[model samples]
Every structure is written in structure tokens, then in C-alpha cells.
Target: MSQEVRGVIARGKGAPVEVATIVVPDPGPGEAVVRVQACGVCHTDLHYREGGINDDFPFLLGHEAAGIVEQVGAGVTDVEPGDFVVLNWRAVCGNCRACRRGKPWYCFATHNAAQKMTLTDGTELSPALGIGAFVEKTLVHAGQCTKVDPAARPAAVGLLGCGVMAGLGAAVNTGGVTRGDSVAVIGCGGVGDGAVAGAALAGATTIIAVDTDPRKLEWAKGFGATHTVNARETDPVEAIRELTGGHGADVVIEAVGRPETWQQAFYARDLAGTVVLVGVPTPEMKMPDLPLLDVFGRGGALKSSWYGDCLPSRDFPMLTSLYLQGRLDLDAFVSEEIGLDQVEDAFGKMHHGDVLRSVVIF
Candidate 1:
């Protein structure tokens, strides 16, 4: 039997989201229904509401979430009823070429629930990032549920479902930050701080955080940044270089998606140092022109991270454990918790740059 639950929905572009009745179907083969405990309001959800992602109007918003598995459909073994899990967008497909090469994190064909979630009137909803979670209960492919420590707080650990995970993976997985390496993260938002925390966890000796906002830079310090650079006051490229003994950092992470910031990241790393782009840019933005000679002279990898290049199955559990052990401060990321009805208000807070994350608690 299908269940009707309250969910946040953006009925059209530029329209304020509202709590509406959504129909959540029973898990079919390879699917599962999750009783969402907490869901974070992400910029991506706002993008969907603003029609920035596509014409997928009537978008079921929210993705970063933690929940309990209400039920599992037949043929599903990855998760079962009563299990505590964090919802993730990327559910790796084993048969993909990337998976075959042992890089399942790069699986080209990620999984989403095959069945459509709909409004009470039977209008189909486009789930944001294939996992609409700003609801009391939601449906997803079984692989999208990654089991984690039940003891962890849903509001905190749920963040690993998206932005937090992306930032950490950008530093540890994509940038290959290591002990003794000097890492400079541009943009001190949630994603940038995640990189700062990741670099700290990886034992990077120096973690420099750069941002235009002083408050965000202070937040980065809480996440383990050793130094903060005010990009508006100083040139980030030169500052990072000076901090690294005139050689720039070993890894420079661009958490701001603008072309101008990316250009700074390019020149803020030492020779052969990696530059990882974790920030998202608009479709209309073009890559800045670069001297081919400079690219050749740098002699290092330039990479764009997709969801922090994370494998949910592997990273979620490990990160959850780290959170439990007190080494990772996931709780610091949650600026406040709101009810589902306040999602529209939360979106407004997102624009003010005052909150790191506004989460919806069931």
C-alpha cells in the first residue's frame, strides 16, 4: 500500500516552497522507503526551486538526510527495515566501466528509485538529486541507503550525505592531501570547512582557509584551519605562496565555483601540486583562458570532484565512526534545526550567509 506523507515541494520556478501531501509508494524490487528523521536545506534544493537545475518543476526538495529504513523491497540486501542510514545521491552500479576498474566511486550509472513519487493528485515529482528527503518519509534505491552508527545525531551525521562529504572528499580523496602536506582551501563555507577538517584529519601540517567573509573564515578555524586569508583584503595566490615559504601550498582546493576563484587556485599551488575544484559553477560560466605553457609548466593534475569522489558505502560508515569517536565535529555544521513547514524560511536564511546549515527535523 502507498502512504501519504507531508513533504516540501517547489511547485514552480521562483515560487516559495510549501509543505504538501506526497504519495510515497511501497518499495518495489531493489527499492526502500526511508522515514526521514532529519534533512538539511542545501543550496542545491534552492537551485531546484529557482529553476537553476532544470525545468523540473514541482521538485521534491532536500537530499542531505538521515533516516530509518521503514521497509525494503524484495531482492534488496544492502539495507533492511529498522536500520539507521544516511541517504546519498550516488548509488554505485557495479557493471559500469568505472566500477569495473575498481573505482566504484566514479560509477557512471548511479541508481535512483525506479518508481516515481507523486503528489496526491497523481502529478509526478522530480526528486532533487534523485532523493527527495524534505519529507517525513521517502523512497530510494536500496543502494542509496548507507548504514551508519545509530548513536550519532541525525542532524549532524546526516550532513555527510552531501556538502560535508563533498568537502572532505575533495581534500582527502581528490586532492590527495596527506601528512605534512600544506593545503589551502578557497571559500570558507560549509564545503570549504569540510576540506579544512579533512586536511586536518589527514595530518596536513598547514591548512590555510581563504574567504571574503570574516565570519566564515572564523568558522573554518573551528574546523582545523591553521591560518585564514581574507581574499578581499589580500590576493589569495600570493598569500598562500607566502605562507608556504614562497612555494605555495602542496594542494589548493577551490571551494568557490567562480572562474576568478578557480584562477586563483591554479596559481596558489606549488609546482606539481594538485588543484581540486569542488565548488559548483553555473552552466553559463566558461572556463578562464589559460596559457598552455603555464599548464605544462605546472606539471600537476587539475581535477573536478563529483560529490567529493566519495564511495558512500566505504566513507559513510568510516566517517560516522569518526564522528562517534569525537575526532570529527559534524555537529558544528548544523547552525539550527527547523520544522518542515519552515523550509521556505530556511531558504531565506541560506542567502544571508549567517547559517552554515539549516536542518529539518521530523
Candidate 2:
């Protein structure tokens, strides 16, 4: 059966997203209909509204989400009705060349619902990142529904579906942060704070938080940052070197996708330390010039972390359990709980860096 649900949609570029009635179809083959409990407003949703990603107008926005499985289509064995799950965009296909190489994180192909979801006027809607959950109910591939510990709060745990997971994965998985390691994270946004928390959880001794915003730096402290570097007040690269005995950190995670921050991350690492770029840079942005000899002199890896190198099946469940155990401070990420109507206001606050995440709860 088709269902009419209230959802947020971006009709065109640079236009405000509208609350509209979207016709969500029943689960098709390999898809599941999720009764969304909560969804987080992320920068990607705003990117969709601005047409920064692509010209997929009438896009159903909001992907960082969690919900209960309401129905599963044919051959969907991963989840069943009544299961609590976090929606993930990456539904890795096991047969991809990357997966065949035993690195499913680099899976060349990911899956989404084969069928189309449309607006009330019958306009086909592109689900943001292929798993929009701002609506009361959404249809997505079963692989997108990662079953997790039901005890975790929907709004808090759902964040793992995107930014939080990306940040954490950037540090633990991509950066390979380890105990006694000195780590620095640039851009103390939700994702940056997640990297800070991930570093702390991984036993990093000195987790430096870098950002111009004092409020965000404070927020990062709550997430386990041992040192806070206000980039506006001091030269972050030199400060990082001073903090780490003039050598810099063992791992530096660039959570701000700007060329300046990327360059800061490049120079703010130890001689053989890793640099992880998890921030999404705009196409107009070009890499800054640096000495090629320095690149060769640095003996460690400089990697780009896509979705924090997340494996939904493995990471989501483990993160959920950690949250339940009171180890991962998921609740700290939720700055406010709001109804669907407040999404636009939430975006405004997000733009001002006034809130970490304003979650929409159904």
C-alpha cells in the first residue's frame, strides 16, 4: 500500500525546503519501509537544498536517522518488522570488486531501493543520499537498515547513521588513533567533536580540539578533548607543534573541508603521523601549494575518509552497545529536539554554529 507522509523536500536550488506530503510506497524487493522515530538535520541536507550535490530537485531531505522496521520486502533477511534500526546510506554490495578484495568498506557498489518514491503531485523524489528519513515513514533497501541495541535513544543513536559515525571512523578507523597517541582535530563541529570523542575513546592521551568558535570548543571538551586550540587567537599549526613538544600530534583529523584547514592538518602532524581528511570540500576549492619534498619527508599516510570508512553492519551495532554502556556520549551530540516544522529554523541555527544537531522527532 502507498502511504502519504509529511516530509521535508528541497524543490529547487537555493530555495527553502518545504514541508509536503510525500507518497511513500510499500517496500519493493530488497527494500524495507521504516517508521522513522527520529532524524538529524545535517549539512548534507542543506547541501541538497542548495543543489550542491546534484540537481535532484524535490529531494526528500534528512538521512541521519533511526527508526523501526515496519515491513520488509521479498528476500530481506537482515531485518524484520518491529526491529529497531539506524538508517545508513552505504548498503555495501558483497560482490563489488572492493568487497571481493576483502575491504568491503571500499565497496564499489552500494544499494538503494529500486523503486521510486514521489511527492503528492506524483513528482519523483530523490531521497537524500538514497535514504531519506525526515518523513514519518520511508522506504529504503534492507541493507540500509542496520539493526542495533533497542535500548539506545532513537535521536541520539541515530546520529551514528552519518556525521557522528564519519567523525568517529575518521579517527579510529581512518586515522588509526591509538592509546597514548597525541591527536588533533580541526573544526569542532558535530563531526569534529565526534572525532575528538573517538580519539579519547581509543585512549589518545592528548586530544586537541581546534576551532574558532569558543562554544564549539567547549562542546568538544565535553566530548573528551584534553586541549582546546582557538584557531582565531593563535596559529594552530605552530600551537599544535608546541603542544606536542615541537613535533606535532601523532594523528591530525581535518573535519573542516576547507583548503586552509587541510593545510593545517598537513603541517600539524608528527614526522610520520597520519592525516585524515574527512571534510567535504566544494568543487571550486583547489588544493594549496606545499613543498613536494615535505610530502615525501612525511613518511605516513594522508588519506581521505569517505563516511569515516564505515561498515554499517559492524560499526552501528558496536557504537550502539557502547552508547548503552555509557561509554560513548551520544546524548551530548543532540543540542535540541524539535518537531518537523522547526527544520528551517534548525538550519538557521546550524548555519550560525549555535547548535550541534537539532534532531527531528516523530
Candidate 3:
């Protein structure tokens, strides 16, 4: 049976998100219906509202979420009703070229619910990141539901569904940050702080956090940054280099998707060090000029992380365990708890950098 639930939707470009009645269908084969318990307010939600992601108007926003499986469809043995799960965007197709190569993290084909969630008048709505989780209940592929420790707080661990996971994976998976490595993360938002925390978890000796916002820099410290650089006052590349014994960091993770930040990340790494771009850039953005020789001279891996190269099946459970054990401070990321109607206001606070994440609690 189809169910009607309250959900946040972006009706048009630059439109203020509205709480609308979304019709969610029963799970089809390989699908599941989740009763969302908590959903994080991510910048991507705002991007969708601004039409920065695509021309798909009337988008059902909110992807970073944690919930309980309410129902499962045929052939869905991976999850069942009553299971606590963190919703993920990447539901890898095992036969994809990347998956066949044993890198499911790079799986080109991911899964979403075969059915669409629509509005009352029967207008189809595009779910943000393939998981329109802001609703009271949502339909998604069974593989999108990764069961985690039930004891973990939904508002905190739900962040692993998106931004937090992206940052951590940027450092640990993409950058290959390791023990004693010098790592610098540009952009001290939730994603950058996750990189900081991941670097710490990886035992990186020096974790340098670079950000223009002083408050964000302070937040970075809580995530285990060894040093903070105010990029607005100092050249980030030079500061990062100076902090790393004037040799640059072993890995530079760019969480801000701007061209200037990318260049800073490029110049902030040591020779043969890794540079991971985890930030989402706007469609109109372009890279600045760089000499071809410089790229060769740098002699390091320049990789773009799609969803932090995270394998939700593996990372979500492990990260949630760490969070439950208090090893990962996932709770620090939630600055406020809100209701469904406050999503638009949360976007404003996020735009002003007032909070790391304003999670909606059901």
C-alpha cells in the first residue's frame, strides 16, 4: 500500500523548501521502506534547493539519515523490519566494472528504489542523493540500509550517511592517511572536521585544519586537529607547509570545492603526497590554470572522491561502533535538533556557518 507522509521538498530553483505530503509506496523487489528517526541538514540539501545539483525541480531533500526498517520487499534478506540502519546513497551493484575489479567503493552503478515517491497530485519527486529521507517514512533500495548498533544515537550517527562519511573517507580511503603522516584538511566544516577526526583515528602525527572561519577552526580542534590555520589571515598552503616542517603535508584533503581551495590543496601537499577533493563544486565552476609540467612535477595522486569512496556496508557499521564506543565524537557534529518544518531555517543557519549540522528528529 502507498502511504502519505510529511516531507520537505524543493519546488523550484532558489525556492524555499516546503513541507509537503509525499506519497511513499510499499517496497518493491530489492527495496525497503524506512521509518526515518533522524535526518541531518546537510549543505547538499541547500544545494538542491538552489538548483545547484540539477534541473530536477521539486526535489525531495535530506539524505543524511538514520532510521528503522519498517518493511522489506521480496529478495531483500540484507535487512528486515525493526533493524536500525543508517541510510546510504551508494547501494553498490556487485557486477559493475569497478565492483568486478573488487573496488565496490567506486561502483559506477548504485541502486535506488525502483518506484518514485510522488506528491498528492501525482507529480514525481526526485529524491536527493537517491534517498529522500526527510520524510517520516521513505522508500529505498534494501542495500541502502546498513544496519548498525541500535544503541547509537540516530541524530549523531546518521551523519555518516553523507558529509561526515565523505570527509572521513577522503582522508582514510582516498588520501591513505596513516600513522605519523602529516595531514592538512582545507575547509573546517562538518566534512573537514570528519577528515580531522579520521586523520586522528588513522594516527596521523600532525593534523592541520585550515579554514577562514575562526569558529570552525575551533570546532576542528575538537575533532583532533593538532594545529589550526586561519586561511583568511594567512596563505593556507604556506601555513600548512610551515606547520609540516616546511615540507608540506603528506596528504592534503580539500573539502571546499572552490578553485582557489583546490589550488591551495595542490600546493599544500609534499612531493608525491596525495590530494583528495571531496567537496562538491557548482556546475559553473572551473579549475584555474596550472602548468602541465607542474602536475607532472608534483608526482602525487590527484583523486576526486565521490561520496568519500565509502562502502556503506563496511564503513557505516564500523564507524557507528566507534561512535558508540566514544572513540568517534559523532555527537559533536550535531549543533541543533530541529523538527521537519524548521528545515528552511536550518538552511539559513547552515548558510551563515552557525552550525555544523542541524538534525531533524522525528
Candidate 4:
């Protein structure tokens, strides 16, 4: 049997997402149905609505989410009914080459529910990031559900499903930020602030946050930034070097996903320091022209972080525990709680930088 549920969907290119009656099929083998408790409004969701991701029209828009397992199909023992889980887009397949090599974070063969969720007239809907939760219920592979502590707030911890995880992992996992290191994060948005918090958690001695907005820089401080640089007022690279004893930071995270910011990150790091690019760049944007010799001259690792190079099964539970212990302020990421119908309005607020995350609560 199929269940009719209310879900937000983008019908066409650059069209406003609408709440529609979606037909959600029951969990099939290796799958589970989740009763979504909370889902975050992320920029990727808006990108799908604007047709930036693909021409997969009528996309079920929302991925960063947390929920309870309402039902499980055969062979789905990792999570059972009533288990609190964070939905991850990456559902690693153990047989994949990346997973066989023990680097499941780069797993190339991830899984999703084989069954498709659709509209009333039987039109197939593309679930954003392979796990759409901007609805009352969603179906996903059992591996996509990372069970976490139930004590944590859904609206807050749910962010670990995507952007937050990407930011923190960019610093901790990809950049290898360590004790007494100096770290600089560009564009203090949700992802950049996550990097700031991750750097702080890793015991970075000096964490510099760079952003054009004073308000965002202030928010960065709450995430444990040691210093804030208003990029509008000064050259970020020079300012970061000045703050780091005339030597650039050991690690620089570029979260803006623009060529200009990427250049800033490249120049803001020490000779042998690491640079992590966690931002998602658009297809039309091209890399800025730079001297080829600089790439070889800089002797440091330049890495692109896909979902922060994170292994959801390992990171989500640990981060949630930190949140529960008051060690990680995940709650700070939730700027507001909203309803499903308000997602369009939340998109506007997000564009204007009015909120860090507007989560829909069921």
C-alpha cells in the first residue's frame, strides 16, 4: 500500500516549490520508512528549486533531517522502529572499491530506496540528495539512517545530516586541524562556522573567521572563533597572516565556493599548511587563472571535501553525544523553527542571511 503525504516539491526550473500530495510507498527490502521529526532548510534545497542541481523537475526538496524509524523492511536490522536517526545522503555500499579499501567516506556506490516516491498522477519525483525529508514521512535505505541519542533536539542535531557535518569534517577530517594550530575559515556561514567550531574543538590556538557581514562574524565567535576579520574592511589574507605571527594559518577552509574565496584560502595558508575546499561550486563558474608554478611551489595539500570526507556512522553519533554533553553547541545552528509550508519564505530569509537554519518541525 502507498501512503499519501504532504511534501514540498519543485515543479520546474526556477519555480517556487509547492506542497503537494506525494505517494510514499512502503519500505521494501533493505529500506526503512522514517517519520520525519525535523528537516533543515539548506542552500542545496534552494539550488534544486532553482534548477541549479539538475533538470530533475518536481524534486522532493529537503535532505538534512532527523527522524524516527517508523518501519523497517526485511534485512534492515541496523535501525528499527522507534530508533532516532539522522538521515544521511551517503549510504555506503560495502562492496564498492572505496569501501573495500576502508575509505567508505568516498564510497562511489551509495544506496537509496529502490522504490520511487511520486505525485498523485504517478509522476516520478527525484528526491534531493537521494533522501528527501521535507514531508511527514520519507523512505530511504537502512544504511542512510545513523542512529543517535534520542535526548538531543531534532531541529538542532538534524543539521548533522549535511551542511554542519560538511563544515566540521572539512576542518577535522580533511584539513587535519590539530592542537595549537592556527586556522582561518572564509565566509562565516553555516559551513564556515562549523569549521570554526571544529577547529576550536580540535584545540586550534587561534581561529580566525573571515566574512563581509559583521553579524555573521559575530555569530562565528559563538562557534569559538578567536578573531573575526571583516573582509569588507581589510584584505583577509594579510589580516590572517598578521594574526598568525606573520606566518599564515596552518589550515584555511574555503566555504564560499567561489574562485575569489578559493584564491584567498590558497594565499592565507602557511607554506606547508593544508587548504580544504568544502563549498559547492556551480558549473558555470571556472577556476581563476593562476601561475602553474604556485601549485608546485606551495608544497601543501589542496583537497576538496565531499560531504567533509565524513563517514556518517562514525561522526554523527559522536557529534550528537558531544551536543548532549554540552560540548558541541549544535543548537546554535537552528535560527528558527518553521512549518513545511513556510519553506519558500525561509528560502528568502536564507538568501538575505537572516537565519543560519530554518528547520521544519513536524
Candidate 5:
């Protein structure tokens, strides 16, 4: 039987999302219904509302989430009812060429629930990032649910579902910010701060956070940034080099996703240093024009981190454990908690940089 529940959806472009009656069906084979406990209001949800992602209207907008498994369909042996799990969009297909090459993190084909949840009027709803989590209950592919420590805080660990994971993975897994390295992160939002934290976790001795907002710069400090550069007040590239004793940072992560910021990241690194682009850019946005020589001259890697090149099964559990050990401060990323009705308002706060993350708590 299909059950009626409340969920937030974007009915049209630039329209304010509303709490509507959603008809969720029973899990089909290889699918599971999750009783959403906590879901973070990520910026991607706002993009879906703005029609930035696609023309798919009535998008079920919420992805960064955690929940308890309420039911699992046949062949869903990886997770079962009563398990606490964090949902991820990257449900890797082990047979993809990327996985065949031993890099499942770059899985070419990810999994999403085959069945569609619909509005009461029978309008098919598109789940945001394939996880549509702003509802009381949601259906997802079994592989999308990764079990974690049940005792962990849902609101905190749930962040691994998106932004936080992207930023942290950009630094550790993609940029390879290891011990004694000097790192710089641009755009100190939830994702940038995650990079700062990841650099710290990996023992980067000098971590510099660059952002237009002084408040965000300060937040970066709490995540173990050794220095903060307000881009509005100074030339960030020059400042980064100055702070590193006339040598640029060993690794620079661009979390802003703008070409201008990418240019800044490109120039702010030491010679042959890595530059990781973790920020999501609009489809129309193009790269800054750089001389072909510059690309060739920069002897190191220039990589784009998709979900920080993370393997959910390998990373979700480990990061959750670190959070449990008090070594990773996931709670610091959550600025406030709001009800589902407040999601629209949270989008406003996010636009004005008022909060790091406003999570929806069930």
C-alpha cells in the first residue's frame, strides 16, 4: 500500500518549496524506505528549486540526510530494518569501469531508487540528488544507505551525505593534504571548512582559509586553520604566499566553484602543487582562460573532486567513527535546526551567509 506523508517539493522554477502530501510506495526489489530522522538543508536543494540542475519540476528537495531503515525489499541484504544509516548519492556500482580499475569512488553509474514517489494527485516527483530526504519517509536504493555507529548523533553524521563530505574528501582524498604540508582553502562555507578540518586531521602544519566573509574565515579557524585571509581586504594569492614565508601553499582547494575563485586557487599554490576543485559550478560557467603553458608548467595535479572522490562504504563509517571519538567535530558544522516548514527560510539564511547548515530534525 502507498502511504501518505508530508514532504517538501519545488513545484516550479524559483517557486518557494512547500510541504505537500507525498505518496510513498512500498520498497521494491533492492530498495528500502527510510524513516528520515535528520536532513540538512544543503544549497543544492535551493538550486533544484531555481531550476539550476534540470527542468525536473516538483523536485523533492533534500539530500544531506540520515535515517533508520524501516523496511527493505527483497535482495536488500546489505542493510535491514532497524539499522541506522547515512544516505549518500554515490551508490557505487561495483561493475563500472572505474570500479574495475579499483577506483569505485569514481563509479560511472550510481544508484537511485527505481520507483518514484509522487504527489497525492499522482504527479511524479523527482528526488533531489536521488535521495530526496526532506520528507518524513523516503525511498532509496539499498546501496545508498551506509550503516554507521547507531549511537552517533543523526544531525551530525548525516552531513556526510553531501557538502561536508565533499569538502573533507577534496582535501584528504583528492588533494592528499598530508603531514607538514601547507594547505589553503577558498570559500569558507560548510564545504571549505570541511577541507580545512580535513587538512588539520591529516596533520597539515599550515592551513590558510580564504573567504570574502570575515565570519566564515573565523569559523575556518575553529576547524584548525592556521591563518585566515579575507579576500575582500587583500590579494589572497599574495597573502597566501606571504603567510607561507614567500612560498605558496603546497595544496589549494577551491570550494567556491567560480572561475574567478578557480583562478585564485591556481595561482595560490606552490610550484607543482595540487589544486582541487570541489565547488559545484553552474553548467554554463566556463573555465578562466589560461595560457596552455601555465597548465603544462604547473607540474602537479589539477583535479576536480566528485564527492571528494570518496568511496561511501569506506569513508562514511570511518568518518562517523572519528566523530564518535571526539576527533572530528561534525557538530560544529550545524549552525541551527529547523522544522521542514522552515526550509524555505533556511534558504534565505544560506543566501545571506547567516548559517553554516540549518538541518531539518524529525
Candidate 6:
């Protein structure tokens, strides 16, 4: 039976979101219905509400979520009813070109619930990231539900579904931080701080957190930063270089997604070091002029991290176990708990740089 659930919806472009009753359909083939426990209020959710993602109106606005699987459709085996799971946007399709080459993380085609959850009037709603979860229940492709340790807090562990995971993976998977290496992260937001923590967790001796905001720098320290540099007060590239004995850091992560910060990351790394761009950039933004000689002289890999280049099935469970063991401090990311109706106000806080994450608990 179709069930009515309360959810936050973006009615139109740049308009305020509202709490509405959405009708969640029964599971279709290769799909599952999850009873959402908690969902994080991320910048991407705000972007969807503001129409920065696309013109898709009446968008279901939450994605970073954890829940219990309630039902599954035909041919489902990986997850059964009552399994605790983190909802992931990327549901790897085995037949995709990337997947065919044995790179499931880069799966060219992902799947979502075949049936759409609709409004009371039968208007189809677009789920943000193909996993609309800012409600009591949500429908998704079975592959989108990655089972994790039930001992972890849903609100905290669910964060691995998005920003936090992206940050961690940027360092460990893409940046390839290693023992005794120095890593400098530009922009000390949740993702940037997560990069710092990931570097520390991966045994990088020096983790430098750079940001314009002093408050965010303080927040970065709690996330395992070995040092903090206020970019407004100092040239971050120079500072990171000086801190790393004048050779720059071994790895520099750009998490601000601006051309200036991208340049900073480029110039703030040691020769043959990695530069990982995990921040989302605007389409209108243009790259600064670069000498062809400098690109050749740098002589290292420059990479962009998409969703942290993570494979949900492999990373989610490992991260959840780490969270359960207190090795990963996922709880620090939650700045506040809110109801679904508070999404708009939470967006205000996000805009003003007030919170790390305001999660909606159902």
C-alpha cells in the first residue's frame, strides 16, 4: 500500500521549502522502502532548494540518511527487511562501462526506485540525489541501501552517505595521504574538516586546516587538525609551505571550489604531491591562467574527487564500525537536531556559517 509521509519539498526555484505530505509507493522491482531514522541538512540540500542543482521543482530535499529497511521488491537479496542501512545515491549498475572495466565506483549508470513517490494530487516528485529521505520513509533501489553496523547512531553514521564520506575519501582514497606526510586542506567547512580528520586518521603527521573564519578553524582543531591557518590573516600557500619546511605540504586539498583556492592548493603542495579538488565549483567559474611549463614542472597527479570516489558497500560498513568503536568521531559533525519543518531555517544557519550540520530527525 502507498503510505503518506511528511517530507520537506522545494516547490519551485529559489522559493522557500515547505513541509508536505508525500505519498511513498510500495517497492518496485529491485527496489526497497526504508523507514528513515535521520537525515542530515547538507549544503547540497540547500542547493536543491535554491534550484542550483537543476530546475526540478517540488524536489524531495534530503539525501544523507540512515534507516531500517522495511520492505524489498522482487530479486532483492543484499538487504532484507529490518536491516539497518545508510541510504546512498550511487547504486552501481554492473553493466555500466566503468563497472565493466572493474571500476564499480565509477559506475556510469546508477539506479533508483523504478516507481516515483508522488504528491497527493499524483504529481511526480523528483528525489534529491535519487534518495528523498527527509521524511519518515523513502523508496530507493536495493543497491542504494548499504547495510551498516546498527550500534552506530543513525544521525552520525548516516553522514557517511555524503559530505563526511566525501572528505574522508578525498584524503585517503584520492589524495593518498600516508604516514609522516603533511596534508593541508583549504576551507574548513564540514567537508574540509572531514579531510583534516581523515588525514589524521590515515597517519599523516601534519594536517593543516586553512579557512578565513576563526570559528571554523577552531572547529577544525577538534576534528584532528595538527595546525590551523586563517587564510584571511595570512597567505595560506606561503603558510603551508613554511609549516612544511618551505617545500609546501605533501598533499593539498582544495575544498572551497573557487579558482583562488584551487590555485592555492596547486601552489601549496610539494613537488610530486597530490592535489585533490573535492569542493563543488560553479559552471560559470573559469580557471586562472597557468603556464604550461608549471604544469609540467609540478609533475604530480591532479585529481577531482566525485562523491569522494567512494564505493558505498565497501566504505559504509567500515566507517560504521569505526564510528561504533569510537575511532571515528562522527558525533562531532552534528551541530544541532531539527525537525523536517526546520530545513529553511537550517539553510539560513548554513548561509551564515553557523553550524556544521543541522540534521533532521524523524
Write candidate 2's Cα lDDT for 1-362 as tens digits: 89999999888898887899989888988999999999999998998888788997889999999999999999999899999999998999999899999999888899999988898778999999999888999999999999998999999999999999999999999999999999999999989999999999999999999999999999999999999999999999999999999999999999999998999999999999999999888768898898999999988889999999999999999999999999999999999999998899999999999999999999
lDDT of 6: 0.92
lDDT of 2 at 114: 93
Give the backbone clash total of model 6.
Answer: 0
Pairs with backbone N, CA or C atoms under 3 Å apart (clashes), candidate 4: none
- Against the reference, the lDDT scores of all candidates come to 0.94, 0.94, 0.95, 0.94, 0.95, 0.92
Q: What stretches of model 6 exceed 4 Å from their correct place?
A: none
The sequence of per-residue lDDT tens digits that candidate 4 reaches over residues 230-339 is 99999999999999989899999999999999999999999989999998898798887878899889889999998989999999999999999999999999999999
Q: For candidate 6, lDDT tens digit of each residue in 1-362?
A: 99999998999988999989999989988999999999999888887887778887889889999999999999999999999999998899999899999999888899988999999999899999999998889999999999998888999988999999999999998898999999999988888988988998899999999999999999999988989999999999999999999999999999989998999999999999999999988767898677889989998888999888899999999988888888899999999999888999999998889999989998
- Residue 121, candidate 5: Cα error in Å is 0.9
Candidate 3 segments whose C-alpha is farther than 4 A from its true place: none
- What is the TM-score of each predicted model, taking all chains together? 0.99, 0.99, 0.99, 0.99, 0.99, 0.98
Give the runs in model 4 whose Cα sits over 4 Å from its true position.
Answer: none
Give model 4's clash tally. Answer: 0
1-362 per-residue lDDT for model 5 (tens digits): 87889999999999988999999999999999999999999988998999889998989999999999999998999999999999999999899999999999999999999999999889999999999999999999999999999989999999999999999999999999999999999999999999999999999999999999999999999999999999999999999999988878999999989999999999899889999999889999999999889889877889999898888999999999999999999999999999999999999999999999999999
Error of 6 at 212 (Å): 0.7
